[model samples]
Target: MIAATPPANATIASTGAAGETASKLDAIAAQIEAANQRISSNAASIETAAKRLNTLEDTLDSTRKGSENGLIVLAKADQRLADIQAQIDATKQTQTTGAEAIANVARRVDSIEMAIAKSAAQASQHETVSAITGKSADTASQPALAAISQQTSEPQPRIASAVPAQTGGHITAPDTAKPAGDRANDAARTDLRIAEVEQALAFNKAADINTAKLVAELQAQVSATQQTVAGNTDVIAGTTKRMDTLDASMARMDARIADGERSLTANVATDSDVAKLVAELQASLASLDKRLAGDEQSLTDNSAADAETRIRVGALEAGTAAIAGTTGQLQAENKDQGKRITSLEAGLASVSATAKEALDRAIAAGKLAEGKLLFETVLSEAVAEFAFDKATLPKAAKVELKTLAEKLKAENQNVYIEIQGHTDNVGGTAGNMALGQERAEAVMTYLNSEFGIPLHRMSALSYGESRPVADNKTKSGRAQNRRVVLVVLK
Candidate 1:
């Protein structure tokens, strides 16, 4: 201190201070060097950690990409599955429709077969009746009478030879008187001849009548047979058409089923890929868990410096968590998409069922409309009633006829009326014929005047006792035979 009192030189003190500061700086530099080495090592470790984190992040990104791709593929697969399921449902519906159509066709085929059998039976019955009628008529005619005569007649007398009288010297013979038996025989023969002629006439008349009846019966039988055959043919054709439609529908269903099967097979392959992706994702998750455990242990070991490092660590953890949260959200979205696809499939099935029901109802309504039109047209042409005793309409009949006339006039159309009179066999032929004609004329006059039916549109016909429809032997039949028919023509 006494030496320093010699005078505190500023430069010297500054130099000393500079040396000490340099020394202190050198020590600080040495410590900083050590710190720098530690920091460099730490930086290297951090670089390595960063590299590992980057690698992990890249791996995570790859995993995330793969998971996203897998989810996208899963979504596609789910959509495809829905489409396949829809196709499968459609195929099932088509199969059901085809089965129903086939059943209907089978029923129609059975009806056709039954109609054919009935027609054949009726034709056979008609043939049998015609044969029996012919046999009975033949047995009651000339052949039986000839057989009776042959059994009752006696042998004829032999005539004398003319050459014998010349050889005995021309002896003259007196004419022999006819015997009573001969005369009786001659008269009987004449009566038999007349009776034979009468029998022939009766047989001819009967034959003619029988021939007409046979013709009519044959015609009716043929018509019935033809109608039955036509009906059977129509039924068969309808059945065949239905069967063809069913077959076509079945074919389409089969095709759809095959397509569904192919799609399911492809989906199974896709599911295998999805399984592989899940395994990879599990491996990635396990690796991330190991990394997180290492990070937690590193944080525990750095507890003295935890306050400073914790902020960075928390930031990194937060970043990793955010990434994980984003991945989770993506996975959730994929699952939701799959659900939506399933719901769409169910909706499509409902729509298909509704459409089929609507189509069926429409077809039924059209058939009902056509049937109603046919019924109305038939009713319009039908005869309501016939005249009481004559073809002539009563005053009440005229009133009813006028109503029809007014209806026709309202429709702006012409109507034709035909009056036909029939008589019972009780009356004489000429008298019945005259009465029928008079009744027909009376009806025509009423229709023309009261009903305002034009003369050109009104027609009248008289069928006498000859045209009786029922047996004259019975009172009920005779009453039924006496009638008039009124036909309305379109």
Candidate 2:
């Protein structure tokens, strides 16, 4: 019997499967490239949006500064208006006081003038009475005139007596015919009295002129104060109108600020949405990468299997050719070699059985290796919680790592661990990536140093802000994002 051989159809089928796998790999690669391009485009869009937001923020800041300056200027203007109004009130009060004082001075001057007129009338009437009574009243008039002259020594103190002294001294008492010496003395007294009366009238005229001048000056001052008050009133009114305009402007500014806030809020929401979409795309890319890795692994396994099958087929063909040569030699050596042929046939059957057994052992080994490969896929994952902006492992994370180490030690087969680090979106992409890497490396180092796990069996990877399990808008979500995950593969 001829040694059993794998079918040609089986080889063809394996080749087709390999070709199909290669084609799938090419397709997956193209898809991954497309995804990368899309990611780049999305990143550019996000950058543009961030720039726009920054510009809007700057605009709002400028607007706020301008508004504050406007308020300051308005406050200063208001203060200036208050000062002017105060000055106006003070000026008005001064004008009123000056007017009252001037009126009082005018009243006093009028009373003094009335007293002078009344005294002059009394002097004339006494003169008339003395003339009508003639010599009978001459003796009485002489004593009265002498008394009046004594009383009117100071004209301001005895205005009524001043007029009598003036008239009586000039009248010469009608005793000029008595004696030349007496008449001369009477004439001298009359001249002196006339001189005193003329001096008093001059003083009164001077007082009236001074009073009028003072009244004129006061009126001028009051008129100037009134003008100043009027100007101040106009200034106050203008200031008030300006304040009204400022108030309206401030109201408009407030409205604009409110609108800006609303716009900013809407932009924030849009940014959140964009972040979610990016996250989803990143997750899809990760899934695709995982699938691609699996496919590539399957392809490698299939290729190895095909190479082994080819090697076995080549060995079987060489053995079959050798057996055919021996059969031909035996047939050529003897015509009646039937027993020998039977012996050769038995030996060939034994060789075929050995080959069959070896083939079955090889298949069993392949199955075992395949099972090991299947088990080598990701087995489990655990979270290593970390604080915000910190790469240090927490106590709980250390405990978990310890447990993991123990589990790894208990396992018969070698285990590999992948430490994946992540971070919130609080920092720049590059910074976050660096931080994530540090966290991942920290976890890997802990596994190696504390648990004695081999460095070659662990790997550190940083996803940064690209991968997120929760919304980054909330504190708790951001905390959750800043974490390390250990993926175990056995």
**Could you say which candidate leads in lDDT?**
2
The CA lDDT of each predicted structure is 0.46, 0.56
Residue range with the least summed lDDT across 10 consecutive positions in model 1: 373-382
For model 1, residues 43-138, the per-residue Cα lDDT tens digits are: 454455446445544644654564465456556555655655565565556556545544553443344334334534543464477587775543
Kindly report which residue pairs in candidate 2 clash with one another. Answer: none
By TM-score, who's the top model here? 2
**Tens digit of lDDT per residue, candidate 2, span 175-214?**
4224434544654664565567556455555655765675
Clashes of each: 0, 0
RMSD of 2: 21.7
Please give each candidate's TM-score. Answer: 0.24, 0.34
Clashing pairs in 1: none
